[model samples]
Target chain A: MVEIESMVPIAAVVDLVLGIATLSIISRSQGTSANNRIVGCILGWILVFLGLSYIMTSILEFRYGALADFSAVDRDKVGGTFAFTAKNLLLSSAYMLMVLLPFFFPFRLINREWDLWFLLAGVCVACAVFTAMHLMTNFEHFQVENFLFIPGYVVLISMYIRFIITEARDNDERLRKVSVVVGLVLIGIHGETMTYWLSQVLSINDLFFQRQSIQSGLSISAAAWGGINTRLTLGATAMLVLCAGEAWRSFKVGLSPFGVLTFIIFIIGFVAGLADLAVLDVVRSCYETQCEAFPVAYTIWYDFTSEALVYLYTPILFMFILLHYDIVDTKREENRWLIRIIVILMLLIVSSTILELIQSFLPIPDMISSAALAIVVGIFIGWEERIVKSLIDDSASIQETVPDFALPEIEHDFASPRLFNLVFGGVTAFILIVSLLFTGLGVLG
Target chain B: MSSDDTITSRSLLVTRESRVPTAVALLVTVVMMTVTMVDFVGDLRATDTFTSNTPDWNLTFDVQNYTMQAVETLQDDETRNLEFDMAEVIIPEGYSLGLIDVTITSEEEEGISVQCDSVAGDLIENGLTAQWNSPMSNLSGQDSSCQPIELSLQVYPDFDGRSITVSAVNEYQAMQHWLQDGWGQGVLSVDLELDVNSPLGFDPIGQDTDEEITVDVTVIMFKANISLVE
Candidate 1:
């Protein structure tokens, strides 16, 4: 059982890589807009950050030395050690943000279909509910609370698969459908990572069992890798796919001369990273005795010039580009406020990314997951219709650029969201306030 | 539809939804009351099995020194027979082990030594009876009768904690058969009723009968021997 369980994270890593490649191929074949492609890129880097975070934190610290401030005591702690005390808390919060960030796409974008939105909402809710169970599990009588998370796995997996099968059909905009499918795969893998997190918490005592103790460490590493790697890989691939597709489509439609070159550069950079990862695996395995060699090679080839390595500056670079794009395009100005909101939401996404980086190994509370869900709901209540219509319009633009293609017919038929937005905003604000009271007042969180 | 009419309809719908909790509460109350009544009826017919009105019969233990040693050893061995001195055994009711301790001072010159040894378990021919051998005769002076002795058996039962009772007992009638014709004739009979209750300090014979005897038998102590019911 120990040896088998030790292979779980390896399997998860393989699945994550496959899932990312699938997204890349699907996006390349189907095509998507520039914005969705950008979101996909952000998500891809986030996953890589998650995977690396898991690896770094897994390096056990066994050193104990005299402290300058307290000479009598040694500070080093044994076993699975973290660079920072709050690493798990941060990673958990990041995974939660990933689970929720999709709900913010404006109404025009989501107008293509409601199932995708519902599935995303359902996954967010499941994440939040599981998070609540995780928090409640801190109670001494943890059985019932821990048991609640099992059902969440079923719900999330089923929802993701449902979203995948339904969106796989060749009907509407293939790029959007591919984005949704990739998103589902990422979500599915992330959800599985959550199952592993819950298993760790529930099986902590079981570690003493001969079979479990040996596998526990490896299982922890694998789960963490599965979680963060899938997010980063799939997230980055989707972004590159959507962005390259956008630039290529624009070029095909006679938009720009340099669009094809930009598209090729993005694809080559992505493929190069994939190749480097494969090479890194071989070298790291062979030089297992020389610990510093892999890190040195990784820093040079994989970490330094990696396409998704820009995620280190993701929070800043993505916003700068978005704001810059808004200036160059007039229609982007009409949606400039929405774009800024996206930037803020992306900032929150980055927070989850940072959290995920730390979460690579440990867990944070479910409250953070809840906050992310509230943000998602607020996004949906605020912008689903606009996002859907924009995607649909972008799709229609492929066939013709006539006046009738200006907007879809049901834009007017969709219910006015003023009431919904107000309610959603009110509820979100209330929840935020309550969370603040709980955490800040030292009552509960 | 007019704005006022729409507002009125919305208010009515709100009122209807609000009544749901109240309806649920009422249903819960009715169900709870019915459950209580059913439980109350069920408890009324439950039977009482642990109490009874009949008095209990008890057997007390007392032995001479030699018998006490043998019985104490037999207590540990479940299959061993507890040997006892049959001549020394004294049952407290009408039955006794052997001839009662009797003294007869003859007022004649000639003295006859009469001994009876027929009080053995194997000599009993029927329930509660023992055939006897004695130098005596019937009222017609036939050879089938034996000389009878006017012997009185004193019975003392140990009752501790009011644990023993002899209900519907006739101690006088049980003792009056000592002067039957075959037993003794032309002998002055002085019936001495003995009542000995050591623990309770209540003597039924001493309270009922006014007969006085020259010798007195006092019960010195009473102790209980308790065992598990099985």
Candidate 2:
């Protein structure tokens, strides 16, 4: 019997390869501007850090049969290795970075506006301190680090939204639509984060989970059909369809073969993600009963389907960026055969997803479904490579133009020192009041 | 006409014909909004009367290495009741005891049967049995091969008694007088469980798996009064 836990390392290895490929493509591409290069590099590093963390966690979990913190485990049982400590540090750092990087995107780190830069720096420091506290603490429950993390997430997302609005304000009709679509996608990604924050502030986590009837109803509703990921997929699919429509409207032409292939793969992935959510609902309903008899296979199927969508998402985004930027040299007819191969490959992947979904309810050997899925994924990586290479080549020959949409140059106000002092004073006063309130409650209780 | 003029005319045509599509989109949006609102309202109604039951008070006792002894006052032929002062639990005022459960666990190699008899107050003979072999049952004979047994006793609040005394007898040797000495050497742990009901009988609203409330009945052994309210 294949242990579901063993698949963690395999998935981690795949993630690491994808991360490395993304970074290498970005670094080697001569067509990307310095700003795009910086953004791409940061995104690549985010994936790399996440992948490494997963690898470390999987290793430790496989050895110990559970993911235990360094302080929680017996060193003798784990061969006195420092793997747990390293895993904690890596994963915590990755989480902090993931929360912080969006604010720094489009090169906000070098902004001449001192106030914005100062705020960003302060947020970074807070994140670092909270991450350190999370690492050092042995008590895993009732953490105050959550206070900092949630606020940091909120601030970063707010900053990104502000950036998008500023971009849209100065852009043409087409670019504005693009910005709006991207904004919707970003909101979908962070919707769950905001919900968690609201739950924490209201102390409603228990109440929220206890509404089984509501959850069941939501499981069937279109708005929350597949839970949060369904919403995400909806936003992403909308973006892709809008982009395709825009391409058609502007160029008065049909999609290139590459575009068609990418679209097909994305739709298959979105459907598969939705199907996985339904499978999860089924598994959860029967988890303690029917699924208990075949725990490993059910768990592996759930993880595989879920992770497949996540893996597909990054490549889909890459394809979307290519389409939105009009980087594909469709006029070149040399790669027609390659496109045909890609189309065939994508069709196979779609068939595999359908097969896997059907097999999810069947009594067939899980290995057959797993092998089919793995083969397609292996082919997908190579296909992604060819597409990225073609886009890079096309982009190199493209000349820079005064874009119909241009970002507005931001000027920092030499804000009167007195106003700055007043603002700082108010912030300090608020912090003091909050601290006093907490201290008073502690003392009285 | 020139190509640029043709393109401009086409764009105008498309714009003029866009009204139907725009209205259709608007209609779809409204329908989606209505569905979401209806679902939201339904969920609110479902959870409106939902409330979790929280026990007003709970008392748990952990008795370790309790060695059973034959009553020396009685002759072996008369009765072989192996007795120990399992635990003495006190329920605070304003809260009445609604349930009492006892679990006896042992790790001895030999199998034994147990029965409980009330010395004072009322303990309803609600026969509820729970048996589970220890994970180490497959190990050597020296290893703990015993199973856990649970006894649930219902108590009435009308009894108005704050205290209760119960004695556990080894049924296996109680019937065989020849094994009285062997049964005396048996040691087991006991857990005394009590649930106190609310005065108004209003169940608490939600269950928090994170923070479980447990009251130590062993504190009663020191004659200390404890009341745990959740």
TM, chain A, every candidate? 0.35, 0.48
DockQ of each: 0.00, 0.03
Each prediction's whole-model lDDT (CA): 0.29, 0.35
Which lDDT value does model 2 have at B184? 12
Model 2 lDDT tens row, A383-414: 76575446444442111322322233244433
Candidate 1, CAPRI quality class derived from DockQ: incorrect
- Candidate 1 residue lDDT tens string, B1-230: 11112222122112332244323333432343244324322321110110111223343433221111111111111222222223343334333222222321111111121211111011111121222332221111111012222333222221122433332112222222321222111122122222212224333343322211221111112222222222
- Give the docking tier of candidate 2: incorrect
lDDT of 1 by residue, A1-445 (tens): 0110111122223223422432342234223343333334334333433443333233322132211110111112312122221223223433443443333221112334453335335534643553354334321121122222222322222222222222223222322332233233332333222222222222221211111112121122222222323333233333333343345345444333233433443554554445444444333321121112233333333322231233333333323322322211213334444443444444454444444333333354557655765676577547655653343233322113222211232222222223223332343343334334434544331
Q: After superposition, how far is residue A96 of candidate 2 from its true place, in Å?
A: 3.7
Q: Which candidate number maximizes TM-score?
A: 2
Interface RMSD of each: 28.9, 15.8
Flag regions of model 1 displaced more than 4 Å: A1-124, A133-290, A293-313, A316-445, B1-230
Which residue window of length 10 is worst by lDDT in model 1 chain B?
A: B137-146
